[model samples]
Target: MSSFFAAIFLLGLCLANAIDFTTVYEWNKFDFVRPSGVDTSNGQIGQHFHQDQVYFQYMAVFGERLFLSLDSYSGIPATLVWLPTSGSSTVPPKLAPFPSWNLHMKDNCDTIQAAKGMEIDTDGRLWVLDQGSSKCSSKLWIFDLLNNDTTELVHQFPDSVVSHRYFKRELRDMVLDKTPEDYLAYITDSFSDKIVVYSRKMDKSWTVTTPGRKWNSLALSPDGEATQLYLARYFSNELYSVSVSELKNEGGRAAVKLVGEWFNIPCRMLIDSANVLYAAFKYQSYLSKWKNISEPFRDQRFYEVERLDAEQPFTFALDTNGTLWLTERNATGSEKRHKIIKAAVGARSYLFKPSTAMTAPQAYVSGGETSDDMKITQTPTVIVISLLVCCLFLCGSCQCVVNLVRMRRKQTSLRQISKDNREQRSALVPVNL
Candidate 1:
């Protein structure tokens, strides 16, 4: 019994060590090409054609539509391109001028240079943030697809908002309110350390500070009850977040509370139907998923699902099925149309990185049974069987020790009996002689 227990215990330990490394996602790059003789106006151009245009700042997807904003220096012709779900099905989707938005006549691709962030409103109005003129410009362009017109310009940062201070090359991205509201918008200015909120009713006239000014990229929680904001430092690759109640005014003040932080640089972010955050950073071209971010998911928290190193541009949107849509820009410069790759959450490459909350061993260990239950509630039952086997083996090891002791005592008795028999036989033979 003891030996059996010992064997079982050893087996349990070996099984524990035999667990394979956790599964991580691996992504493949899909290339969409331009059909022969197709118009490449708003088409994606790679470094092969324009070596100077190295950066693709922002990209957004609404329904079957896809859009991207290029850098001012990028020699790429069109500022933005619109893509669809079904098409000629052969080459990259054709490109046309992203229909002009508010301030159309005043808006030139030059003034709208370096469009960093974009959002599509409930009415299908395309809102784009132009870091305008490498100087201070607080204008956002709104293109109304419903009316096929440029509706209105939202001035997120006005000279008054800047308080007469010169903030050149400001304004990064814009985050839209998720819950049904009166159309509120949040804009981040990397240089100014502030987020400007604009209301559509006011015609983009008013500007207020946002929760965090240090980083860019904001996401709406799945329930649309709160906002998740990401602040990524360019220098150190530190990514953080702040959560704001979707319904609450920033305490009558524009303030952001920090919540989540990760080690890598998160340059861009998008939210899925479940509210998981997909972060694309400059560290590597691979996309990562921060699954199930908490409300007010603040800075210094978030899990990393998986990442790809291929130099593909990252963009996010949901398909008709509400599955997350991911597109990557090809830098190979091999095709006329910059590739627009599509990936659904079902893709093998899709990953879920639990927040430190999920992966922190110490936190769970310290939390007692409640914490352990919360952590593995969804895990399979095989884990319990494994534990039981380990326990059984440990119990058997004690019985094996007892059986060995009894076997030793029996051997000693046998030896004593044999010695006594031999002495009696010798005495009988001597007396007869």
Candidate 2:
């Protein structure tokens, strides 16, 4: 019985060790050719002819399509292309030139020089963050993806927002708030440690800078009641939060409070619909998450989900279905190591429930559980069954022992009765018979 219980425990431990992390897409190189008969004199013809010079920096997902943006910091033309998630054997088709002008045109509002960060809002509009280049000015481009094959540029940030200061700013990542009453956009400037807030309705912008907080990444809280902005610094692993109302006030610098130290240095982070915060560690090649946003960072649960090599330009995107897609940035002048990896973290509906307070997901590292979530709440069903079987076996063994004792006593009593009967018969018969 003890051996049976030991076997059951071993089986349970083996079952807990199984987890799957899958790689969905990989490529040895990225190549794109200019369409036939395109004019070469304008210089737009050679834009994508030299595919070896291009490298991927950022990515965003909309529906079944994945959008990639090139780094172009080294004189390559910044490019954007979308391909089906079903994996393609060839280079993705480039989005057509903006309707008003050709790609070769200088200072064109339609072109993207360097896109470091982009996000898809709830309204299905894709907001692109262009850091600008020698030819282009720093600007925000909004496109309606639901429109024709050529994504139409619906709106552009005004010159007032993209001023001289913007040119000096190194915009990293952005989050959109499409609330009916307040349409706000929060952008982080890693170089200057500033947060830029823009209002769509008023068409005005404001900048907020803190003395100690050096902003690197920003994520909006999933809670709809309080508008909170969570941001991290360039090299610091600490997380901080501030209210949007305070940040928008032009009166003074908003009060920024430290949420807690994340311990792992984070490069980028995103908040899911469940209000869970997922952060990609800088050069650590692993993704970790905080299950609860409202709770204090120390009290909240953290789990590490995926692990990869220490590669430059690591980035990730979360899809509508709660799947995380990640890849390392391709480096210029280096052998291509292009790959897109994805992990299905179950659907949002299954993972999130409004009634129940969401707890952190369980994760194992090197075959050992890492967080408090791994604590066993109740005995497993298999272990319970094994215990019941052992109890039944013990009961049967006790019953057999009782029966054997009863039989031994019965035989001894019968022997005594036979001796008494023989003695009495001998007395009834003649004395010495």
Candidate 3:
């Protein structure tokens, strides 16, 4: 009976590992025929240049359309393309420029210089981060997907927000907070090592510079009430988190705490309904999942989902139907081909499981009280002291109690020093200690 049960358990584990990630589309070079008489000089290329002049930088899905943004780093025109999601052609037919050609001209106010990253909200609105063309200012553009197969520009960041700083900045990725009372947008400026926050209600924005060099990716915690923001640096394996409430209250250079660390620098991350964080590595070409977000990093909670043989997965998107999509780009920038892959990771329900309560780290403030969410809770020393006092009342052995108290005090002091060192390393600004 014991052997039979063991065999059945092993079979179940094997079946769970059988899920395969399917490659939906791959192209050596993006080949498609444009409309007749379409000029290839300025913004009228018949197709993406056969050489490595064009590269797919980001992707997003809305309804029946699958949208891709082309990188302008190679001097190609900044453009976005959309095709029917149901089509499965080796070379996609009718790949049309998004919005319209009128919006792509240099003199137009709606012209996009370069779009590096994008996000689609729950209301079907597309938010694009324009990295700024040579002649244009960096801005964020929001478009509403209308029912008539067209889009309307709803909002654009003012010139005041983009032109405030004299130094060059590169806005990379964004995450949205759609709480009822607070609708905020957070964007990462990789080049400047800053995080920019925009408040929709107030129509205002602010910037916070972090301690690291390349702060690339951002994700919101699964908890709705206490929505903490998770940030990952590009070249480092460390992951950090900060409270959204604290950021809004204390604006510039707010302190951040180290939450978890991963094996590789994650290029893109997605937090599912179950609070599971899925990280995609750029050069490593493997997908990993951290199951328990509140716990410290451990090999037990981290699982390697799948490995891409040769392709490097960059940007990722989760569709309405719970399908995961990734853009596999040529990491070396030498290969001309790229791909789009999809898989079902079994997250489908409308209701998300409540996230486990996270223990907040101790933070030092200048004068004001520490934020409620940043306050550290009961420590092991408190429990030990309480037990020692109880023994004093019950048995009252003076010599034995003195030795135990001295030993615990030494241990507690050592622990405090270690914690202080960690806190110093995690602060966004230099600490006096």
Candidate 4:
């Protein structure tokens, strides 16, 4: 009996270790190709393209294409582009622009001056925050991705709500309110340490400030309503939250409350529909997850999920396919190149409601109960049959343990998989027609 319990415990440990992210798509550096047939790798006339100048910051998966936001202020060909989902995981695909090549013109008021963080809504609309150049004012750009990438809304921030010192780059991160009453955007303006709130229905903007500056990441709880806005500041382990009700005030006096504080400083944060919170520490090798928001963040509630070669997950996103996608840190001196890593979450993104959470069984769930329940009656013949069944089961217990060990070994060996391992839809064309 003790041996049977030991085997069961070993199987549980194996399942926990199996839920991890492995390297999928990787590149020493990114490549960009414009719609007009201009390749950045070709070294065109008067064009300067440096391999060290460009790096990806944030990403959002809409349907079949994974959109990436390039965080570069100079020498980058395109700041916003995408890669197909059905391509070779080993081969780095040439990134195609989001909508068109013309929209990426630098310092143009009519185009995206600087592409920063972005989020995709359930309606298939891509909401982008553009840190405008010295030649243009900061603005918000939304595109109807479901409708041929048509223009949805373009609004410029007035001087009253923006920081005079860092107006061109103060906007750091933003999260949309999921309440059905009205649409609001809570954006982090780190230059002045303010949370800029914008109302889509009223077309008005306001600002809210918490304790620390350098506000880096923002996540909304999976309640499917504007309950709390989770905020993480750089170089800090304490997480804070503000009520959406108080944030809706144009008066700009929303109260900031400290919710949970742990040992790890979460550089990036994400929430799944199951209400599990993920945190990726800056320059840290391991990633963590918090199961309950109601309880204080302690070692018992927060668990380290994975670790890889001291790999740093700077940016990440949870998709509907039950995958957590992230970008690792890369440097010119380091032998490792920039790579896209993924893990199995077994739950959809927080963008979906909890009741509507979509899930697919993954390696974490593959080793679950695979046998059916048995029943026995009072008959002597039935008792004899049950004894025979129990004798046969006892004989096969060793094989069951062997199969469980083999299942875990199989998951560990094949770390890398080609394509998005979940479900494959028709790949989106790289070029926009």
Report lDDT (CA) for all predictions. 0.50, 0.61, 0.61, 0.67
- In candidate 4, clashing pairs total 0
Q: Give lDDT tens digits, candidate 2, residues 1-433.
A: 4645755665554443332334455555555444566554645444444555555666788787787776554434336656566533334334333222244233464566566677776656677777776555676666677774345443344444444444566777888775657567888877665677777677666677777676888788763557688888777888889987777675358778888888677777877666667777665645667766877564232333334344445677777665666665444345655566554443232112333323333221221222223223223674566556655665666678779999999999999999999999988987555
| Segments in model 3 whose C-alpha atoms lie over 4 Å from true places | 1-17, 36-51, 88-90, 106-109, 147-167, 211-214, 298-312, 330-335, 348-433
Against the true structure, whose lDDT is highest?
4
In the range 1-433, model 4's lDDT, one tens digit per residue, is 5756765655554444445445556676657764455433423212476765567777888777788888754667577888765453346777787787767776567988677778887778888887777777777788999999998898788777774334445676777775575667878766656778887777777776554555777888776445777888756787888777777667556677877775677766777787777777765655677765655664222234234443334678877777777777655365546766665666667767777665543431121121111111135664466456554555477678778999988776665343344223335535568
The ten-residue window of minimal lDDT in model 2 covers 363-372
RMSD (Å) per prediction: 12.6, 13.2, 19.8, 20.1
lDDT value, residue 76 of candidate 4:
76
Query: What overall lDDT, based on C-alpha atoms, would model 1 receive against the true structure?
Result: 0.50
Clashes of each: 28, 0, 0, 0
lDDT of 1 by residue, 192-302 (tens): 555566677656544444433455555554433344555554443555555555323532444455455655566677665454667766545566666556554433222
What is candidate 2's TM-score against the reference?
0.68
User: Which digits, one per residue and each the tens of the lDDT, describe model 3 over residues 279-390?
Assistant: 7665665667766566665422222333434333566776665556666665454565566656555552112334332223222111222122222233567446644554
C-alpha root-mean-square deviation, candidate 2: 13.2
In candidate 4, list every pair of residues with a backbone clash: none
TM-score of every model versus the real structure? 0.57, 0.68, 0.69, 0.74
